[model samples]
Each structure stands twice: as C-alpha cells, then as structure tokens.
Target: MNMKLFIFIVLISPLLASLSSFILKNKRFAEYISLLASSLDIIGAFIILYFVLNFKPIFLFNNAIAIDKFSAYLILLVSIVYFLSSIYSISYMRLAINNEKMTENEFFRYELFFNLFAFTMLIAPMINNMAVYLIDIELTTITSSFLVISEVTEKSIEAAWKYILVVSSGISLALLGTILFYLSGNIPGSANIVSSLDWTVLGLNAVYLNEGIVRIAFVLIVIGLGTKVGLAPMHTWVPDAYSEAPSPVSAMLSASLENVALYGIIRYFGIAGKSLGFGYPEVILITIGIFSIFIGVMGIIYQNSSKRLFAYSSIEHMGIITLGFGLGGIFGTFGALLQMLGHTLTKSTMYFGAGNFLHKFKTKNIKKIKGVFHIMPKTAFLFSIGSVALIGVPPSVIFISEFLIILQSLKDGYYLVAVILIGFLLAAFISLLTKSGSMVFGKADENFKAERGDFSPFSYVPMLLPLAASLILGFYIPNGLHNLLIGIVHIINFKIK
Candidate 1:
C-alpha cells in the first residue's frame, strides 16, 4: 500500500507485462497486457501528481528517484499520452491483422518491442544519473529499431537501418560527452567520477567547472541528441522512419521518443546555464531552432507524402518549442513546456487520424485520397481538428503557447528572432492547410473505395481525449493546474507572469 512501492511497481509493470506475454505466446493478449500496463502507469502518475501538488515527498526507492515539480508534471503528461497511444495501437494494429501484413512471430516481436519502448520512456524521466539515462536512451534505440521494421518491407528495412545508424551514432556521441563530463568533475584527490553524472550534483558545481570543457560537452551532447530530437540537417531519419513504421509505432516515436530527447536538452540547458551562463546554450538553440523551422516549413510546402508532411511539421513544432526555451525567461519556458505538451497530444492525434485514412485508402499519398470527410466523417472531423491545432489556431493550446512566446520575444527586443519565428509559423500553417484542406473538400477519385469496419473505442478514445483536453486548457486554465504549472516554472528558475 505504500506509495513508493506502487510507484516502483508501475515503473516495472511494462517489463513484467513483456515477460508474461512471452509465456502467453498470444499476440492478441499482448495488446491487453500493454493496456493493463499503461492503465497502471497512468494511475501511478496521478498518485505522484497528487502527492506533488500537496507538497508531499515525491521520492521513491531512494533519493535517487525524486519527482520534483517539473518532472511530476511531465511524468503525468507522458503517462496520459502513453496510455492513450497504447490503446490507440489496438485499433491501429487491427489493419496489420486483417491484411496479414506481419507473421505471428513478427507480430509478437511488436508486442515485445512496444512494451520495452514504453518502459524506457517511462524510466528515462525518472533517472538521476546521466550514465544511467544514456543507457536508458540506448535501450530506446534497441527496442524501437524492431518496431521500425514491423512491416518487413524493403523500404521498412532501409528506414530501420538508417534510423539505427543515425540514432546510434548520435547517442554514442552523447554518451562520450556524458563520460567527459564525468571526467571533468573527477578531482585528482577524489574517486567520485560516477557522482558527477548526477544532475543535481553537476548543476551545483557547474560554476566551478571548466567553461571550455563544458561548452565542448554541450555541443557533443546537443548534436548527438538533436538527431533523435529531429532537429534540422540532423533530421534525415524522421520522414523515412515515420513513413515506413507501423502507424502505432510512428505515433509513439513522434509523441514519446521526441519528447524524451527534448527532456534531455532541457536538462542540459539547465546545467549549462547555471555553469557557463545562459547565453551560450541560448544562442546555439536559437540558431538550430531557426534552421529547423526553415527546413520544416520548406519541406512541408512541397511534400507529396502525407506522413512525411506530418513528420516535417513535427520538426517545425520541435523548432518552435526549442525557440521558446532558447528565449529563457518565465514566459518563454512556460510556453515551451505548454507547446511540448500540446504537440504530443495534437501530433499523435494527427497520426491516428492519418493511420485511419491510410488504412481506408490503402495509400500514404495525399493526392490519391480525397473527399475523406464525406466517406469517413468521424476520422475526417478529427483530422481537421488536429490540423487546426497543428496550425496553432484559436482554442488550441499551441496557439496560446505560441502567442506567449512571441510576446516574450518582442518584449525582450529579439525582434529578428521574433520575425523569423512568426514567418516560419505562418509558412508552416499555409503548407499544412493546403494539404489537409484539399484532402477534406476535394472530389474523390473515381477509383477511391471507402473501407467500412467497426471502429473500436480504443481507437477513438485515446486520440480524442488528448485533443479535447488541449482545447479545454487553451480556453480555460484551471486554478489548480495553473498553480501547479507556476510551481514547475519556479523549480526550473523561470519567471512566469
């Protein structure tokens, strides 16, 4: 009954489910196992949130696993998003079942990898040691690599290979940076290299650390992690991976793994600012942010593949989120957090809708499928709403967050950054609208066939709840949630209005 025990149980539940599933040998049961694991995880996250909001001790297992206000909020959000995405997977995977696209063994491989992926995302947020965290992230690559090729197609294999190569190379660089940092903190007199990997300790001693070494480590870490994060020039893997992976896995990659990478960047910035002054990380992030925005917007403008378009849009939003954090004030930081949360919900919803469309139309080409709303009204409606949110329209949380960031930048007199950001956002908006709007209202091809099947609650509920919550938050920020967010902003040392 102890809360700590429950927390540990939830943390371990996905791996437990995977083991049980290995014995069961039934892929059908694997979905159920994932659902159960996700449910318990969400419940545990809620419990943690409750304790944190009441200012109760949120540590578990040891001081090693503490949930401060910032992490508590993110933990709860990831749980909700992860659980919903898992449930949605049940429906999304039904296409694979019907089409016999995967052998039984391969299907079971999906079950195993899915659980491992979820488990890694769950634990990455909780780990205090940089070495341990890097290990956890490497595990993510190991788990997700199989999922990338769940289809067993030549293109899928190619995509998976590229994903593995790029991400592994990036992560290895990051690990080296982490080790160098550990070495930097080794006082010749003390045998405490491992102790330096603790984020709290590194943050405290950042001032005493060598600035040049810190800058080098930061560059290596950012470049390495930014590939996984889908930043510009380093984002080559994103479109191919997203296009080839099973829809459910694509959703998880965009929604969960991307967030995990962002979390790492946030943690690094926290330490870098305290140790080397804020301007260093800020300039790098801003430059990368601007370049990513340009790539995403330009890529989306002429994108033919629907999934690839969404992938590029995701890069743009990641850029926008980075832009907010790069500005580094209370409003900028809060807006960044809000955008991160909003994008997870909105982007996953978009992918779910896209999956349904892809299944019904049997194509990823946006031009091939038209008049979707007329044929599949619910899916079309959801897709339209998701598109609006992605474009940062009113009543979507992204709009609120983006507005705040722009305001903060202007007030700070970063006028050129503001101008470039706003321009890229508008360009992204136009690009998205062109594709989604055409698909919704245009005439269907004479050969187009509308596949009819019973839609599952798992399919709709998981995608809908997050989108609805995003809308509600944009319109009315509840007092309790607002207070919690304020606490989080302060913990991150950001000033909020």
Candidate 2:
C-alpha cells in the first residue's frame, strides 16, 4: 500500500472507532476497540517512520495529502504521546468507573472524545491545505473542550466554557487569516492563479506576495494559533483546564496539542521570514516567548495545585521553544525543534507522574501531601526524576536542548534576554524542587499513608516509556536519530551546525 494511504488510514481509524465506541452496546468491547485502534495507529506510525527514514516524502490522494520529514516526525510524536495516554487512560478511567459520581454513559463519552482529540492532534500535522489546517485546529478545540469537563465538575465546566470561548475566537481569526492569505495571492496580475494555497507555492511565490497583507495575515494566524500554545495573556484557560481535567488529557493538551499549534505558527512564519525578512516575526515571537517564561515560572513557583504547576511549566517551556525559534538562524531553529521534542517527552512524563501522585493521594493540593516515597516509592521516585527533568537538570534531554538554546542566545548577542531566560529557569527549578521534592522525600504529614494501588500494564507503560526515552535521549542521542533530526531540519530549511 502507498505510505500516505496507510498513514491516512492510520489517522482516520481512531475517529471511526471512537464513533463506534459511542454507539456500541458493549462498553467493555468499546474499550477493547479503543485500545486496538490506538495500537494499530501506533503500528502504522512506526511503519511510516521506517518509510520516512528510507524513502522520499510521500504524497498521496493528490498533492493535498503528503507526508514529509516535518510531518512524519510530528506524527511520530503524537503517536508516542497519544498511545501512552490511551494506555494510561485504561487505568485512569477505571478510577472513574468505580466512583459513583460518574454514569456509565459518561465514561464512554469521555473515551470517545479522548480518542477524537488524539486523532485530530495527529491529523493536524499532515494537513497540506491551509483551510484543512484551520479545520483541524477547530476540531482539536471542540473535541478537547468536552474532554476538559468529562467529569462534569463545576470548575471543569467553567474551564471548558472559557476554553471554548478563547479557542473559538482564536480559530475564527485563523480562518479569516487563511482566507486573507488566498486573497493576498489572488491580487491582480502578480502571481500564479491556481486557487491553491499549497505551501510550496506560497514559499516559492512569497517574494511576490503583498507585504502588508501578508503581514496582517501572519499576525492573525499567530494570535489565533498563539492562544492554543498558551502564550501569556491568552493563557488564562490553560491552568484551570489542565488542573481540572483528568491528568492524561492535561498531558495531551500540554504535550501534543500545544505542539501542533506551534507547528502551525512555524508553517506560516516560514513563509513570512523567507519573504519579508525574519525581523518582524522574530520580534513578535521574542516578546511573547519572554512574557510566557516570566508568567510560567513565577506561577509555578507559587502554585498550590500540582497539576496547575505543571500546566504553567508547559507554558514556560513553550516560551523557551518560541525563543529558540525567534533567534532565526540554523542553530537557533535546530535548538527550537530539539527543545520541542525534549519538552514533549518531559512534560508528558511530568503529567503522568502527577497523575500517579493524584491517584494515590486523591488531592491536587501540594501542601497536604508528603512522604510520597514511603507511600508509593516507585511513583514518588519517578515523579522526582520527572520534575528534575522538567527543570532541565543535566543528563535530561531538556537540559541539552536548553543548553543549545542558551548558547545560541548568547552567540546571537541577546545578552539581556539570555540572563532573563536563565533567571526564570532557575527560579522555576527552585520553586518546583522546593514544592515537589519536599513533598516526595520529606516526612509524612498526619494524613499521609501509603495508599496501595493496583499496578496495571496500562498505567506503568505510559509513564515509563516516555521517561526512558527522555533519559536515553538526554545522555546520548543515537546517531541514527540525530541524522533523522538533521534531515528534518534540512527539509524545513533550518540549519543547526
């Protein structure tokens, strides 16, 4: 079969299975179906990765459907995050099942939408048409809003409503921007007249594009996509949503969906920078990135809820990634991509660790829990390691990536910005270490007890796989993987060395 066809099937199968899960009479069967569908998608991702490694970029069903190193790499990422989340959900959802607060139907609803959310996150990267890309972003927002309030709690509902409003507004602007891009290309006698918004066309003809109109389009697209990336000011919905949602969904939001939004920004920025010079977009990205760093680290340092703290950390890391991108050179862009990969693995691991802690303690409050090492030593130990990784401590992938970013920052003569970046990161490390490390390693509080929990394959695999990947990547990135990433950088027109 054609690689793109196989990938397309892989992408669509989950949505079909999710729909079946919603209507199927046997809920147990639906669970199995969900698992099977995700596993198949995972298999397909591995297969596609193999092809991406050995073959040229695959285009299928016309040029509108294509898979390149850029898209293939992201597909692999979503597969890793979503597959693990799915496994984790099996164990996590069992908790909801036992609780009298949720209905049988409600659990199924949650599973259905969760699958849909994962599917859309995967599909967003492969979309070749701007309209299709906008549509995928809209689907992500809609599906995730329901997932946010799966528990139907008052706070979750508020978060969901806020999410719906903010993301909907953002997507609306993005759609308008997409339309404007088409108009910018359609101006009188200036360029090719294919009703096509193909990236190749846009990039090739970018110099001929109307500068003012293109700038307007880029601004709209960035703000629209920026809301999803949890850039500050537009980030109000993230903490509440992540804190209130089930931890796995929070992981997906922070690790997977946010990355998709960043990809969207990069796609547009590529055109702008190649045509209009990197200065304009770099300034905007830098401003937003710095602000997000300040907000994320400060918020995490003082936060009371463990999950909320992770949410803020996600924002901070995203800022770092954006900062790397804004630097706009080969090394800078490479660092940006590396930072993205590292953050995804680290953030998801952090959330999974947080999920384990939440399951044991049944609380989100940071102060109320302590002596987790005694209660659940394996989980506590893992959580502590994950937190260290999040802080970009040495020998973690994040540390290496952030080191590259900082080096690039200094090399680029952004001295003050580098100082601020270091300051925020140090503050964040101190805050999380003080807040989480003590809770895990210190003596038990009066209410603390090792709440014994069942160990399922589903729960352990998700947490461990990504963490192991982080550890391995941190200490030694495999030569093959390094080459693959270098190829991706070339494909995207970024240079690292």
Candidate 3:
C-alpha cells in the first residue's frame, strides 16, 4: 500500500496517454491506449477512495498534494467520466474520420489534448496551493479549447475562442481572490499571522483571518469559479463551448470539468463561512444559485440544437448543486454532493446518446434529428431512459438528491425558496423531457437518409453502463457510498464552523 504509488498511477496514466498518442500518431494505438490509461486511472481512483474512507487524508510531495474524502470523491467522479469518454471517443472519433472529413492530424490532436485535459482536471483537486490549483484549471481550459475545435469549423473556432477568453478571465479573478486569501492571514499587524496560500492551512486558521478581506474574496471566488461552473451572468461561454465540442469532450466538460472548478469554490465557501460566519456566504450562494437555475431553464425551453439543449441542462444542474450547498445543513450539503455524482453519471450517458443522434442524422438541430427510435433503436432506448433520469424522474439518483435539497429548504423555513425551487425544477423537468421525447418519438422525414442502425457497440455501451449505475444508486444507496458522502459533508461542515 504505497500511497505515492497509487497517486503516481492516477496522475501519470493520463499524462502518458497524452504523450504516447501524440508521439506515435497511430489512430488505433491512440484510441486503445487512451482507453487503457483511463481504465488504470479508474481503478486507482477507487483504491484512493477506499484508502481515504478507512484511513487519514493523504499529503505527499512535501504536502504539495492532498487528498481527503472530498478530494477523493471528486477524483472518483472525474475518473468515471474520463473512462466513459475514452470509450465513447473510440466510436466518436472514428465516425469523424469516415463521415465528418476529419484529418488524421486533427484526430491525433484530439487524443493528445483530450487526455491532457483530463490530466489537468485530475490534478486540480489534489494540489495544495490554491494559486497552483488555479493554474491547473487554466491548463484544462487550454487543452479543452483545442478539443473544442476538433472538427475545425467556423462555429468551433468561435466557441474555442469564447471558451478561452471567458473562462480565462474567470480564472484570473479566482487567482486574485487566492492572493487576497493569502493577504487575509497577514494583515499588517496581526501577531497570529499565517501567510500560506494552501487552502488546508487557510481553512484551519480561517477564524484568525481578516474578516473584511474574506468577505470580498469569497464574492470574487464565487464569481470567478462560477463562470467555470456555468453559473449565470458568467455562463455565456457554456452553451457555445458545450455545443461545439465533440460529444466526448462535452461530457468531460459538463460532467467532470465543472465539478473540478466547483471543488475549488466549495473549498473557499467553507473558509469564507468560517471567516465571515455562515450567513453571509450562504446568502450569496443561494441568490446566485437561484438566478443560474432560472437562466438554465429558460435556455432549455428555447434551445433548438440538441447539444445546446443539454449544455443549458448542465447550468441548471450546477445551480441546483450550488443551491443545495447554500442551504447549509446535512441534507443540503449531502444532497449537493450526491447530485454531483448523479449528474456525472447521467450527463455522460446523455452526451453519448446525443453523439449517436448527431452521427446518424448528421446534424445538431433537434428538428432534423427526429425519430431516433426509428434509426438507432438501442441508442434511442438508452437515451430515452437517460432523459427520464436527467429530468429527475423517480428511480433516478437525481430525484433523491433534488428532493433532499427541497426538504432542507423547507426545514430551514424558506418556504418561498422551496416553492421557487420546485417551480423551476418542474419547468426544467417538463421542458427537457419534451425536447428529448420529440426527438425520440417524433416522425422521421419522408426522405430520411442515413443508415437505420446504431454505430459500433462502443457508442452505446458507455451509455448503458452509466445509465444502469445511476438507476441502481437511485434504488439503493450502498453503505460505503452513504458513508463516503456523509464523510464529505463532514469535510465541508467541519471547516465551516
């Protein structure tokens, strides 16, 4: 049980995948190698989770790397999406080669940046220094921007630029907030001064920090990280980027990358709450969370493109997660954390299904993508089931998570808040199902053209795996996961007080 060995396995696997893919430039080698790497990382992540559950938080490399239950949980989520996306990419990129006119160089580029993007996100939560963590997040932006333009279209280029410019600006603000956090502990004449930028140290000494600085810094952190989280007012980049990226990359972005960014924000939320009292930051998260959900549902209602429809759904889900955290109790916080897992499992299934539709119909427009059930029966069946789960239907983990959050709001006596939340949830539930149902059950055009069969098993297998996992979790939450989630709640709650 060498801790460092497992850490090395998790971090280095993706880096090696990125390097070998670019160096060798063989398509099949690149495809299978990426899959092999993700497989290894997934096993490593589970081991890390098991160790964290039974033992102590791990700090290695002179404390430059840290992994607590919270970090372990996030790592597991990222690895899950990484594994699924890699499998889906085999079918996805091959189709691009044969049908979408993708060059070998572009495919090579996709594999290179794809694994690197996962590597960056994998490292973000493990880093001890807040500033260094921000740098890693920025690296994800760079690698993912390349992935966004995998098809090299006008729309893809614009989406890449928009993704970079907007998210980079957000990261810059997060950096400033990190600097302010450092200064908060070193106020000019404080005898009990600590000048570390490591969040572990800052969080432990939050009570000694300057309250005024913590207040402003927390706001900046939320605004900054919220952009990456796809929160409203700062969520403009999300729709374009998610729509333009390949389905695998979109799953990584929506399912994994957003959770990584949010891990940073939640770290600060605890620190800021401890510094300035739980009340101040709770209001901020609650307010912004509500607004983001509003924006997300509106976008979903109006969305015509299949990918953009789900992009807005990401925003809505993130908002619910934030709102759950804002409510600040066991149910609220635990529900939010569970929602992260639920979202990751369900969303990847969705994007893979969407990828199938895109390949079959040769379009992103929902109107053009009708009668998926007619063309790709397996994909349409899974997509339809996934849509039901995505909308928080019963026998889905999302239903449990969202219901817990509502229960928290009611227990806290925020009646209006509960009502508003239920309203939006209802709106999103109806709107998304409508869009997906039309595509699944709608009539195919008289002159419908593409072949009437699903793509390779690679396309649909990934969908089935996660969909089944989500359904099982919904039916029965395992004792181990229940404890792990409770441990994560303690991780956040223990610091906030």
Candidate 4:
C-alpha cells in the first residue's frame, strides 16, 4: 500500500471509530470496535516505520505532513499505548460501569473522547509545521482533560480544570516563542527568505535566523512545551490528572502523551542548537532535567496514592530523558531515545497493574492496599517485577538506558553530574522498591478477604506483554530497532562516533 494511503488510514481510523462508537453506544461491542481501530493504527504506524527505514521520509499535503524515522517511531509508541489501553479498557470500563455507578452516558462519552484523544496524539507528530504541532498538542490536552473527568467526581473535575488551565497557558507561551521563531527569520530584508513555520524550513535556514532572538525564543519554547511534557515547576497538573483519570487514560497520558509533548521540545532543540550552537540548549535541558528529577524523587518518597506515585515516577523518567538529550553524545542521545521506548512499555505495565489493584481492593491509598501477593498473586508478581524494572534493575531496558546515560556523563568528565544522576537513580530505586515491597507483602487485613486471583486476562496480559518486551530488549536489541535508534540519533545531529 502507498505510505500516504497508510498515513491517511492511520489518521482517520480513530476519528471514524470515535464517531461510530458514539452512534452505536453498544456497550457490548464498543470496546471491540475501539480495539480493532487501534490495531489498524498500530499496523499503519509500523508500515510507516518500515518504509522510512527502507526508503526515504514520506511527505504529503504540500509538505505540511512529514513522516520521517523520528516521527514514525513516535507514531508507533503512541499506537502501542493506545492499543494496550483499548484492550485493558474492555476490562476496566466494564468494571467501572458495574461497580462504580458510572452512567452509560458517561461511559459513552469516555469512549468517544478516548479515541479522539488518541487521534490528536497520533497526528501531532505527523505535522511538519511546528505551529500546527503545538495546536495539535493543545488539542490533546483538551481531549484528555475530558477523559480525566470521565468518572465525574469533584476531584476529577478539579483535575480536568487544572489540566486545561495550566496546559493552555503553557501552550500560549509556546505560541509566542513560535512567533518569535518566525520573526527571527523575518527581519527587514529576510521576509521572503523564510515563509513557513514548518520545522524543515526553519531547520534548513537556521543559519539565517537572528541568533539573539533565536536564543530567547528557544528558551520560551522549552518552558512552554515543557509544561505539556510535565517538566518540573510546570508539572503540578500531572499528578492530579494522572491520579484522577481512569487507569487506561492514565496509561495513555503518562506513557504516550508526555513523549508526544516532549517531541515538540526536541524538534525545537534541534532547530535552536543548529542556530545558536548546542551550548545554550544543552545547558537549559540539563538544568531542568536534573531539577525535575529531584522533584519527582521527592514526590515519590512521600506519595500516599498508588496512581500518584507512578505519576511522579513519570516525571522522574521525563527528567532523565531530558538530561540524556542534554548530555548530547551518542550514548546520551541513544539512551534517551531508548528510555522513551522502555518507559512507554514499563510504565504502562505498572499502571495496568495499578488498575487491577484499584479494581480488586477498591482503593488508591498505598497504606490501605496490601498483601497483593495473597490477594491477586499474578498482578502482585507482575507489578512487583515491573517496579523493579522501573527502578532500573539489571536486565530491564530501563537499566540499559540509565547505564548508558551515566556512562555519557562520565565520558564527558562531568563527575558531579554523574554523582547526582546516580544518587537520584538510587534514591528512586530504594524508595519505589520499599513502597512496592510493603504493599505486595504487607500483612493482609483480617477483614479484607477478596479472591486470590487477577482481574480478567486483559488486565494482567497487557502488563505482561510490555514487561516481557522490556526484559528481552535489555538482553539484546534487535538489529532493526538498533538501526532505527541510530537513524534517530543521526537526525538529531549528536556527534559521538
């Protein structure tokens, strides 16, 4: 099939599914439709990736939409999460409707927005225009905020509100920065030289951009998009939204959406680095990266809610990714990209496990949830292993990514940075394992006697697939994936030959 046709199908499938689902509202079949659509999306994304690797980048709509190796990889990541979330939703939404008194209307709305949310994220990376990309990111924020309120409680409502308000403000700042990017190229005699906000155009003409203005604009872009990416000081909305949204939605948000938002920051990082040299962008990313890691670890240390704990972990992981990109060598950049894949797989597994706990025990409080080894042995086992993997234990993809990042710091002679990075990694490892250990093995309450089994196969199976993939990849990255990562590293112009 023509790659453009595949791209069209990939972009339209979710919208068609969303509309059909709302019209049908057949509780019995709605989930299957969603699953089918998401599956198609995954196939399309993979095809695009395959084409990009074997051929050249695909462009359509007068260069308005471009799918290169980087974008293809992101599309695949988003689709993977969307596919898993849809499968898990079959089990999760059913339980929510029956046990939590969720209205059929709310359930229908959830299905509608769920697919729309995925659609927005799917398209964000495909847009060649940076401005349109930000607009698409804003659309994701809007659609997902509705998903946050799918349960319709006061706290969920509050989370949705905060999410919209904060993310919108951040996007506005990013718009200002984008306009500055246009103006940086539109100086008195240069008006006709640069005519589009497409990343390709700006990147090609980066040398013509006013360096002074590009510097300030790049900073604004980071701060603005960083809010959407859940970077620190701009991350207040993430915990609330993640904790309140349904588990499937939380998986999408943390596992896929943040990476989509960070995709914007990275594109700009490439542009700004090309224009103003790597020093400025690298320092900015490294500083924010380290600070965000600190905040996330601190949050993990004190978190009481299971969902919020993982939400904070998302922030920590994002911080690590940001730092990796900032470190800017072969190891650092490759490690960051690898971390993105590892995080998508591992974090989704953990959140799905958390969903099982919530469904089984009917609580999110860490102290109130206990004896998972006795209550739901499969979930407990998978969740426990997932937690270990998440904290960068050996033979997990995360361990490889984190190790590569640390190696980069040492190679660059940043001893203090290396120490701090290791310290934070150790802190996260100890804190996460300690809390998970208490929950998984803590004494079962005398009155708490639920069945000693997992939720439907949907729940634990989704968890198992990602965990297994992470472990296998840790031992050996397949040649195709290795080359894909190398292609991306080249795209980002990191020098580490």
Question: What TM-score, over all chains together, does every model reach?
Answer: 0.95, 0.95, 0.99, 0.99
Per-residue lDDT, model 1, residue 431, is 78
Return the lDDT, model 1, position 19.
77
Question: Could you list the CA RMSD of all candidates, in the order they appear?
Answer: 2.2, 1.9, 1.0, 1.1
**Candidate 2 lDDT, 66-141, residue by residue in tens:** 6777787788778778877877787787866674366777788887898899899888887788778888888999
| Of 2 and 4, the candidate ranking higher by lDDT | 4
Error of 2 at 306 (Å): 0.8
Ranking 2 against 3 by TM-score, winner = 3
* Model 1: lDDT of residue 91: 85
Q: List the residue pairs that clash in candidate 1.
A: 330-495
Question: lDDT (CA) for every model shown?
Answer: 0.81, 0.82, 0.94, 0.93
Query: Tens digit of lDDT per residue, candidate 3, span 388-462?
Result: 999899899999999999999999999999999999999998989989999999998879966789899999999
User: Which 10-residue span in candidate 4 carries the lowest summed lDDT?
Assistant: 187-196
Query: Per-residue error at 472 for model 4, in Å?
Result: 0.4
Query: Model 4's lDDT to the true fold?
Result: 0.93
| Cα lDDT of model 4 by residue, 215-321, tens digit | 99998999999999999989999999999999999999999999999999999998898888898999999999999999999999999999999999999999999
Q: Point out where model 2 deviates above 4 Å.
A: 189-194, 448-450, 453-457, 494-497
Per-residue lDDT of 396 in model 2: 85
